[model samples]
Target: MRTYVVGSGVTKVDRHYERNYLSLINEAVNKALADSGLDISDIEYLVVSSAFTDSILNQVDPSTYIAQNLGFRKTRALTVSSGEVSGAVALDYAHALIRSGKARKVLVVGFEKMSEYPSWIINRVYSKILEHEIEGIKNVSPPEYAAMIMQEYVRRYGVSREDIVKWSIKMHENAVKNPYAQLQFNISLDLLNRALRISEPITMLDSHPIGDGAAALLVTDESITKKMNGALIEVVDIESSVNLPIYLRDDITYFSSTAAAYKKISSKNEIRLDKTVAVNVYDTYDIYGLLIIEALEICGRGEALKCLDEMPYLNIGGGLKARGHPVGATPLYQVHELRELMSGSSWVKYDGEISLAHSMSGPDNNAWLILLRRWV
Candidate 1:
């Protein structure tokens, strides 16, 4: 049995002050169902992914309410949350269900609403992604962790701060062409330098913005694909790995979880970066995005910044930086963007058959890599 993504829908990453969580989910889900040429009745399962539902929404067992809101009375529904990688984790679960002969069609929805909360509260929630016993108790936040990594990376690789700034600038430029991106305006070196500092060497522009958004994908087995018209994107392989917390890791600059997941996928199928149409990486912070490219072996260690010009397809959707990191919804957004790009429906046109999406939890404590191939 093979799993394929037949349809996908994504909302623009923004504050979305007017819409509630249910409304956002409905919009994405309806669009996905429409695109797949399937009615709501066709879906047998629903997988919801969210990170801050408990803290932000004050809702527990979100899957139950979400299924009820979507009118999925009898559909088997569950929620998957693994910090920022919740979307990818949910996707992996849906893919497994189809491969295991459990279901023919699965609906995966990832959503997050962060703008409703104050910055202090949001930061406190995000800090919990760290090792709660150690880092969280000390109030260590993601940006602070990123600053440590960036400092070490610059020291180890001799990469200049200017080179890192260039990465954010390029991401903003890419977002200018992406209608769904949150920060859709091009940025300059001047603005980045002048931006308020979040931590030493990490300014506000270096981090992904707080936003609200939702994305949905309709995953179905090959049997359903036979009846669908046009090409479908196949889930070639989905692999994930876990690493010790950043405090336990010997090297702050390396993402062992990312490398481990990619290695597993590589053993199962040959991944040709040259043939890849686009690569979406988890760039909650600019430095982490650079580190992920290196972990994917797209470039040598510490060479990601230097080779940024060479990897034109990297983060064409503006990445988590400019595109917005709505936590659990981000990975789904990556897949949706890649699907559009492969089908030539994206604003940033690209002609290719393969794409890869990477997502990770805090500091690469857990990571997932999804390989997608266009089945024409």
Candidate 2:
């Protein structure tokens, strides 16, 4: 059995002050269903991915709540929460169900609502995603970790800070054309230099913004593809791995989990990195984006900045830096954007058959790599 993504949809990545969780989910799911020309009744399973429903929304069993609200009377619903990688985890579940002969059609919805709370409260919740008892209590946040990694990368690689700033400028420029992106305006190196410092060597401009958003993907077996006229993007392979916490790791600049997952996928699939036209990486911070490129072996270690200009296909959707990292919903957005780009429906034009999406939890404590091929 083979799994194919028949359709996908995403809501604008922004502070949805007027929309609630159910409303956002409904909008994304409905758009996906409409794109596939399949009704909600056609879906056999519902996989919901979220990270803060319990802590922020005070809602328990959010999958059940979403099922009940969405009129999924017979469809089995499951929830997946793996910090920031929840979306990719949920997608893995959906793929398994179809490939294992359990279901013909599966709907994966990833969402996060974070703008309703204050920055202090949101920051506290974000810290909980780390090794809570250890790193959480130390007052070290994600930005600080990113700063440590960035500083070390510069020291060891001899990459200039100006080169890193170019990544942000490129992302913002790409986002300017992406209607769903949160930060859709162009940025300048001078402006970034003047931006407020979040940590040493990391300014607010380099970090992804917190916002509310949702994305949905409809995964179905090959049998269902015959009946649908929409573009089909095959789920070539999905691989994931876990590593020790950043504190336990020997190198702060390397992402072992991401490397492990990439290696697994490479062994199973004959994917050519040079031929892959688009790659969506977990760019919660600029340094993480650069690190992912090296970890995936797209470029040699510490060579990302040097090879940055050579890799023009990276983060065409603006990445999390400008597209907005709504935590659990982010991976789904990557998948959705790749689907659009591969199908030639996106603002950015790329004529390629393969695309890769990368997502991670914390500073690469856990990471997932999804390979997608455009079906001709």
Candidate 3:
């Protein structure tokens, strides 16, 4: 049976000083159940996105604890972790369960709590995702990885600082309308260039915020979805590709996994990039955003900036750049953005026909792309 996402929910991306990880999950799951009109007992599977465990916070075994606390004792529970794309991986498992006749309905929840720890602790955790031996031993962060990617892109295409800065401006502009976005405020070209640089070509404003948030979605197939009204989306296709690490790849500027996945997708389906209502590429940094546009070949490799005027819905929910990447929960947030954009829950009424949510991990070596056709 074809799967459909019938319900979705996302907590505001910000520092929840009072809420713990369990509280955040409860808030998002309850909202999703209420919206989908599904009782807690109706859910047969629970897939939780698990990323990091903070020693300072005394957290452990998130999936087991969360399922029990949410009163999902009898339901089969599993956890999926792929660095920052935990949510996407979890969604894939949930989709397979029903497609395999394991369960008719499943609930996928992704959440992360980063504010409880110090900056250095967060850095150590993020560094390990890329390459534990090198990055973790040397204490290298994710932004530093993006910096190397940006510098290489500049050398290859002669991309100027001005060209790269425009991408950040576009992301910020899109975030202003998304209330769930952590950094909704806009920034000008001057501010972007002058802003403190973390890794050359990327500034503080260019990266996604560090915040705590959770998102949940209800997954079922098209057959059962017909009984419900119109609030559902069809998962037309799901594809994934894995490439060698950045150090092993021929070109660090290009993401081979994205290319391979899209190449396979294009042969089977007609992907009208121009017709897509929302395209959520993993935008770890502004330069990462350009590489995303270029990798998909949505527009010309170096011409991503020129198409910004027309790609207003590029990151309807500000993407990871402004919407805040709670790491594990981010892909789920992208799914939420698609639902809101089609349901008229977005800041403005989106006249969109199709939306695609894509996420990459380990510096774009691995990718997961999900195509959604609007049923509203």
Candidate 4:
């Protein structure tokens, strides 16, 4: 499919959801329309993404409700729930529909209001995303599972606790400059050094906080992009991996789904991931980020450190740790952030090449990758 991102937008990611879930989505959708210089009527299709909103915020079928609120009563809209990967999945669906000639312009919006519930209740909601047999009955929190993976990753990669803390410090430092970031605290290495330790090596600083936010993207056909003089950013390739039960997996160090999806994208497209100008990887936790980096084969088995020194593009937009991971909105925010960097609106500069965004889930635990470029 020849899908190009015409425009994108995001509301400041924070817990200030004085508005309802649908209202948040409409605000973001309107922003995307304004950014693209298009009206709400211009969107032929719309996809909505959220995970805990319906359960915690009491807003089920947000797509229909949001579309009506945005004056998209006549347009087709569907809700997508895929844990944290819902945003990426929604993008994939829009791209496919456009490429298949089923739609012309699609509006994709992702949102979540996690602050609606208390922290402990929110933790319970996330735990439901895990397999019941392996994690549900055990009442293993998401951070607990992540901590288990962190233990394995540390053993395999020889990554020290200090290395992860350094990453957190850098992320928060970057977040201070991002006005939209929820955790704008400019933390130093020393603070992260002593930040409350949650699970052995995994500390409270290492995990993404429960924030509220919304993000939107306008994807159009290649022809429509030129006709509208759209700020073209090509969706070069999109791939998704199947869900895997954590306990059934062969190795925690290697995410089979991520590896498979990366391989598929590599074989089908001319994506030079290593040379990409910028990258946004799913980073709900430091360990998860490390796992994805390794699984994508961006570096050698135990060479994340070496890769880090070479690749500064990894999560420069502050990632989930710094940018505030608002669940469903995280990936969409990544796409928007990458678009800004590619369009030279960001502080960083590149040769006008490719940028990538990766998103994952915890329940089905699906993982997805979206590769983009300024020019094909």
Each model's lDDT comes to 0.89, 0.89, 0.80, 0.79
Q: To one decimal, what is the Cα RMSD in angstroms of model 1 from the true structure?
A: 1.3
Clash pairs (backbone) in predicted model 1: none
RMSD of each: 1.3, 1.3, 1.9, 2.0
Q: What tens digits encode model 3's per-residue C-alpha lDDT throughout 1-376?
A: 8788888888999988899988999999998998888888888888998577543356655778888788997888877777777888899888888788878889999988878877677766767677777656766677887888878877888867667877777777878888888888888877864788777666887777778999999998766687898656876777889988777888888877887887776667787566245788899888877777777778777667677777767887888888888888999999888877777777867766677788888678678887887876
lDDT of 1 at 310: 74
Q: After superposition, how far is residue 278 of candidate 3 from its true place, in Å?
A: 2.0
TM-scores of all candidate predictions against the true structure? 0.97, 0.97, 0.94, 0.94
Poorest stretch of ten by lDDT in candidate 2: 270-279
Give the range of the ten consecutive residues with the poorest summed lDDT in model 4.
Answer: 270-279
Model 1: per-residue Cα lDDT over 1-376, one tens digit each: 9999999998889998899988988999999998999888888999999998998999876778988888887788889988999999899999999999999999999999998878888889878788878888888888998999999999999988767988898899899999989999988888866898999999987899999999999999999889877778998888999999888899989999999998998778976564144899999889998899888888889888777887778888999999999898999999998888887788766767789999998889899999999877
**Candidate 2 lDDT, 1-376, residue by residue in tens:** 9999998999999999899999999999999999888889888999999988889889866889999998998989989998999999999999999999999999999999999899889988987788877888888788888998898999999988768988888899889989999998999988976898889899988899989999999999999899866557999889999989877889999998999998889888976575145899998889898899889888888988776677767888899999998888999999999999888898867878789999998889889999999877
Q: Tens digits of per-residue lDDT for model 4 on 152-257?
A: 8777777776676666766776677777888888776566657787777677788887788899999988767766653468888899888567777777667778
TM-score of 4: 0.94
In model 1, state the lDDT of residue 371.
96
